[model samples]
Target: MPLKACKMFSNPTSAPKAPSRYCQKTLHLLENFKTLVVMGDEPDREILKMVARTTIRTKLYEALADQLTDIVVNSVLCIRKPEEAIDLFMVEIMHMRHKFDVEGLVLDHGSRHPDMKRRAENCFILTCNVSLEYEKRIFLLKCRAEGGNGCSLKASGR
Candidate 1:
């Protein structure tokens, strides 16, 4: 048995006009098996760069605003910080969930793991992080904030 796959580029103008010979051959070979084709907008370099600096929680909320039912936010409290603030926040969140009859609570942990995938099958788990390739961006921002040139900071490996 053979399957043929057909992909429809949402933006026809963005689709490559002529694929390479290797691509044509691969497509020809796959013409007899079941194939699933997914189409999406090409990644934007500027958006990708911005995402690298943004936190996972902010990105998830922005992307899934309509679908999100409940969210649990965690914060660290020191002795100088008011414990009642966190308690009140949790109480308010619980009240909101109860009033709205929220369906699911998504936990954003900022990193991925094997257990995360398993837990995601049962509940929503958000895993997103600033990739190592973008570490330079963070460093540059810190350097700028400290009134130092980013290039010099990178050269010094600080």
Candidate 2:
């Protein structure tokens, strides 16, 4: 796919509409930022939210905030050096003439994967756990891949 420059965008698969099934399937509860901001002043928002959400882990919650905060920093950096973002949108057309150096499935939409709940366009995924080549080091502790392709990654260490 051709790379198109944008002023801002983090999710290549971000939907065009609200209450998207694709998004809801990935997340338990999706709320507009406006809704969170509207409950202003009298009470603290983060504490109230954490109390209401019994299952959310403190570290994970903080991570999300950290990621959102990064958008601003990233955006400024990208704007200053936009040429770096050209590799952000990726797609492939396979044939005998040209081929990917690595073996991996490239699908047009996220929903094309059996495990995904809904469709997404221009999605981008990155994995840093294992490199392009096979892993060389052996794990001292028992560890296994969390999920197959077309699924969410869920891994933990004991």
Candidate 3:
């Protein structure tokens, strides 16, 4: 069988559905992580959260049950080359809470253009790197502690 077919058989749970703009990419990311997770064995809590947020948001969008992801995607895509600060993004996402749930967010911090770096840095300053394991856990706990906390599940569609 072909590699893609083999993978589909091996990891049916993470397979992407057709007519999905993100399905194939999501499954590919999961497969790549599956390999990396076992070697060196350090869990990238941030990345896992990123994937989860991406998956959930994408599904939420495709399902059209909520417009949260659509708003975030629009805002981020609208930002020029670099990007705006995380808080700005969060605020934008927060504004759409009436349309969807914002339970937890995972900001992507990979290096890129100056604008991208600025965006990530701003996120760090805003959330104090809450996407990081320890801080992220605290953020989750605090959200749960509160009744209607809006968490930004940050992830780049790239």
Best by lDDT: 3
* lDDT computed for candidate 3: 0.43
Alpha carbon deviation, residue 133, candidate 2 (Å)? 29
Once all C-alphas are superposed, what RMSD does model 1 give against the true structure? Answer: 21.9
**Each candidate's clash count:** 4, 0, 5
Q: Model 1, which residues run further than 4 Å from truth?
A: 1-19, 35-105, 109-129, 132-158
Candidate 3 C-alpha lDDT tens digits along 50-147: 44456655444434423344444444434324433224434432233255544444344544555554334335433343342211122222234466
Task: Provide the TM-score for each candidate, comma-separated.
Answer: 0.18, 0.16, 0.19
Measured by TM-score, the strongest candidate is 3
lDDT of each: 0.38, 0.39, 0.43
Off by over 4 Å in 2: 1-35, 44-158
Off by over 4 Å in 3: 1-35, 39-42, 62-158
Cα RMSD, model 2: 21.7
lDDT by residue (tens digit), candidate 1, 9-64: 22344445433334556667767663443223332334433333354434445454
Q: Which of the two candidates, 2 or 3, achieves a greater TM-score against the reference? A: 3
lDDT of 2 by residue, 28-147 (tens): 333333244333333443644444342323324555545443343343233333334323243335354455543333334222456765766897756345332322333343335566
